[model samples]
Target: MFKKIAVPVLLAVSGVAAAAEGTTTTGVDLTPLTNSIDFSTVLVAIMAVAASLVTLYAGVAGVRWVLRTVKSA
Candidate 1:
């Protein structure tokens, strides 16, 4: 009973508080590091390579299992 009422009230209060705060910004400059490249693209490429390697390993293991089963039979 208390939970349902309290949740809505709390949400309403927080919404009002956030609206009051608005979009305030502090003036901090990052112009010095503009020349240094963003590593986001490189990070994504590395993740792709890792995923491909894992898939290849799984595929090779499956092939080896099939071959061993055939030989035993």
Candidate 2:
């Protein structure tokens, strides 16, 4: 409907405006050794934490299911 078309239209207009800006037209300029710490290593650590939380939640859910089944029998 209108909602679906409106999103794309707005996105296209925003993209066009961004392209008109010289900064967006050209790629970002960055120098090497700008930071003391590597960002990639931080990202990997965050991902590992998120994965561990997911596994923990799944294990808890399974345990709850087993207890519920036992109580019903």
Candidate 3:
């Protein structure tokens, strides 16, 4: 049942794609827009620093808890 429905749908989609193959305009220049400043590196660095600080804080808290537990016992 699904095969019957899917075969016709696939053929229709291929026909439409073939019809649209040569309709695109190729006259636009996009080099300057694509060469703008890269901010992904800076964003990744900021995220790494933030994650390091959080890990450091968690480690310090865990050590302090262990020390307090030992002192009380």
- Cα displacement (angstroms), candidate 3, residue 28, comes to 25
All models: lDDT?
Answer: 0.93, 0.89, 0.95
In order of appearance, the predictions have TM-scores of 0.51, 0.50, 0.52
Model 3, global lDDT: 0.95
Q: How far out, in Å, is residue 73 in model 3?
A: 0.2
lDDT of 3 by residue, 1-73 (tens): 9999999999999999998896777867888887897889999999999999999999999999999999999
Candidate 3: residue pairs that collide: none
Off by over 4 Å in 1: 1-35
Question: Where is the poorest 10-residue window by lDDT in model 1?
Answer: 23-32
Candidate 3: where are CA atoms >4 Å away?
A: 1-35
Poorest 10 consecutive residues of model 2 by lDDT? 24-33
**Index of the highest-TM-score prediction:** 3
The superposed Cα distance between candidate 1 and the true structure at residue 72, in angstroms, equals 0.7
Candidate 1 clashes between residue pairs 3 or more apart in a chain or in different chains: none
